[model samples]
Target: MIFSALSPLLRSSALQNLTQQALLRMDAETAHGATISALKLGLAPQQTHTDPPELRIALCGLDLANPVGMAAGFDKNAEVPRPLAQMGFGMVEIGTVTPRPQAGNPRPRSFRIVEAGGVINRMGFNNEGHDAAYARLKGLRVPAALGVNIGANKDSEDFVADYVLGVKRFADLADYLTVNVSSPNTPGLRNLQADEALRRLLNEVLAARAKARVRVPVFLKIAPDLDETALDAIARVVLATDLDGLIVSNTTITRDTVAGMENANQTGGLSGKPLFNLSTQKLAQTRLRVGDLPIIGVGGIHSPQSAVAKFEAGANAIQLYSALVFGGLDLLDRIKRGLAAAVRAQGKTNVSELSGTQVADWAAGKAEL
Candidate 1:
């Protein structure tokens, strides 16, 4: 009731901060739902400042005002991309939408690791099926570049076919499409990342893309828990294909950093502050192998420092989600401002110039975790 009554005053930093604290006290999923409801009602905080010119980036033919994007999963069913875009993300990605809707894992599927600035979720891609998301995204337009992350249904007979279907379905609706085979929640999904399977998956998905009325760029979202061999194999397969780019990681099943924390042993992918090192290292490694291909880094980017770390590690663009749980909408603006400052300090004219500058250090595991 307070949220509704004070809707017009959400732009006040003090009011928005209090609202964030209130949401943090509620159940994670309930808070998530309420946040989405507020956005749908156009009650979310709006961005009043323009992005700095140095932050502009041209990602895969899409001229983004900045390189920061809202990762998938936050707007899983495409209910609030327009509002999220208005809130300042240069890009807003929605879904991990399957061919068919499924309830996903049972209740209590999301857990917060407040002490570690992290979250563990076994949500299992619970999204309204293709038709639902497609209908919502069909005619909608937003200032930010829009991306649709797609996945196979839990019960699909042919996983590759499901991805092909996604490419065909949203090709005309989205600026880009993400082939998400890295989410740990879905059984056998990560197996799609194996070299041979990845090769086959990309071939079919790209073939389908070739038939689209409007060819959309496709990016492969990989997992953070990969060894040198697996990473090399993936790089090889990806380089051999016409895939537009790569999303350097999804969440990680490894809890090495949050070892003794509560919910550290949860059976789900871990994301947030603890994920930065591993994911950034993987991003650097992937960049080294893939050479000039574009990479959108995601995972554990909780601050502008971490955001800059992603670009220095070789991400042409970056996305964040879990951090929003702890830092609220203020985090987005803070990171953007921080990025502009960092770019100026580095004497770079554009934020894209920072990409891969520190790749050697990150890939060599020299950067502090």
Candidate 2:
């Protein structure tokens, strides 16, 4: 009840910081599970769903209360969507789910690099599979928009079939669906981002979406480590495919940017503060290639400044995961409130007004991904 009176930021600071301190005392994966469990038990404080006009925006046609979202991997099993939504995200994306259940890599798969304000995760596409998530999602309700991020089972035989199955199974449940071929932990997953493979994949995904009962929007989440040629190739497929939007640049395999930090050499995708620059640049680059297509920016967003940078770099909206690990769920409220402040400071009424305004600048000098 202590939190039932305060605004999101104040409430979060009053509660989440203490929770985070306790969670931080545990291992990263354990902390994540505990957090999820707490949310499921309704222990997290509820946040008002109201959004300032400046933060209100429609993404791929779904009316979001604000632009900030809970990215996939936070609630991989679709366990606590409403609790997360209550924690203040305008959108909550669950799972990199597959047609069947998977245990992911192994224990110790998630590491927090406090010095770098980053996380190195090789958890693979671990989840309870499509059926479980589908069941929970079907019974789930939330004020925020929900998206299901789907992936191929690590040992899946028919990759395309898995995606098609995911779409057909959950399209009716999700506000939108994300085809994730970007996670570095799944072996050969990123390879699917290549030109020919990407074309074939997106075609199937698009076709699947077309046939789904809901025909919800479909977005492609790509990796940040792509080269120019790979990016150009993926862009062609994005342009050709009737995809709904793109989640620009998943976590990175490269440590060059966060070089010399402990766990910097960890063999997993790195995300958090260091990812902001690369992912934003990649978002700008994608926007340049696929003009007018909506994009959900992810990677390294830990503050209002980074969130504003994401919108300027061309994101229709943005998602955050690793930042939440360090900043807690209330970080979503902080970023949204901060973004609204930034928008008002610029004399803007809606967040969309700033989307892609600085694409030319970031894309111009951005080093090839």
Candidate 3:
């Protein structure tokens, strides 16, 4: 009733801040559910101004109003991409949806690390199967570029087949497709990143894409926990294939930065502010290895500065989700403004010009933290 009452009120920054505080006091997953429910009811803030031209970008041939995107986990079932787009995300990715429905890990699986501005969840790609998401996405259009992130089912008989099936299911519907093999909660999923396995997976998935009526760009979403050697192998495999791009770094399992904080020992992937440095470093390393290949950076972005750091670290576009838990939807406007300022300050006409500018420094561990 309170949310319903507030729906007709002007969706202002002050109101959103109050709403965020209220949500934070609830259970993490419960609050997330409420937020999504609110979004579906059209009770969310709308971007009131035009994004400056400097923030415009073309990622893998998909034109975006800005590089900011809602990462996959936020709208796991493709429920509210349009509202998220209205809230100012230049791109919106939905689901790590599987071919079959799954209940995922047990309750209390999502934890908020308040002090560290981070969240940990073993959600295990829980989502309505392909049919549910496809039904929502079929012929649906939104202003922001839409992407579908697909994953293999937990009980999948053949993981590569699952991915191939996903490619066929979404190729015609999405502006892009992301093969997500990085979620830590899914048993043995990260192993797919291994060079040989990755090569096989991409080969099959791409083959499926080639058969689709629409050949949307396909990107691989990898984990941030990999070392330089692993990054090298992945880069080598990706470059040798017809894969369109890469989403640099997903939620991390390591928690070195949030060690003493509450929920620090949670047995799931860590995301939000603490993930920035490691993910960016990995992104830069991937950039160095695969020159000119597009990369969408995700993880640990909470402010405009952090978002800009992603581009400097070699992301052609960037995505965020956990930050919204703390910063509220207003963060999107702030980031777009910050990016526009960054572009003008650097004397660049477009934000894409900033990509990889600091990759060498970041990759070598010389970037300012």
The C-alpha lDDT values of all candidates are 0.88, 0.81, 0.86
lDDT of 3 at 335: 88
TM-score for each predicted model, relative to the true structure: 0.95, 0.93, 0.95
Model 1: per-residue Cα lDDT over 72-155, one tens digit each: 998899998998899999999999899999889997788888799889999989988999999999889888999999999998
Question: Worst 10-residue stretch by lDDT in candidate 1?
Answer: 1-10
Off by more than 4 A, model 1? 1-18
How good is model 1 by TM-score? 0.95
Model 2 residue 50 distance off true place after TM-score fit, in angstroms: 1.6
Tens-digit lDDT string for candidate 2 (259-332):
88877877899888878788888888888988899999998888888888888989999998887666755677
- Residue-pair clash count for candidate 1: 0
Candidate scoring better on lDDT of 1 and 3: 1
Rank ordering of all candidates by lDDT, starting from the highest: 1, 3, 2
| Model 2: residues with Cα > 4 Å off, grouped in runs | 1-19, 366-369
Worst 10 residues of 3 by lDDT: 1-10
Among all windows of 10 consecutive residues in model 2, the one with the lowest summed lDDT is 1-10
Give one digit per residue, the lDDT tens place, for model 3 in 1-369.
Answer: 011122222264534654555666777887777767777877777887888999888888888988899899888899999988887889999998999988888888888888988889888888889999999999888789999999999988789899999999999999999999988898989999999999999999999999999879999999999998998899899999988999988889898999989989989999988988999999999999999999999888889998898999999999978877777666778888999999999999999999988989999889855
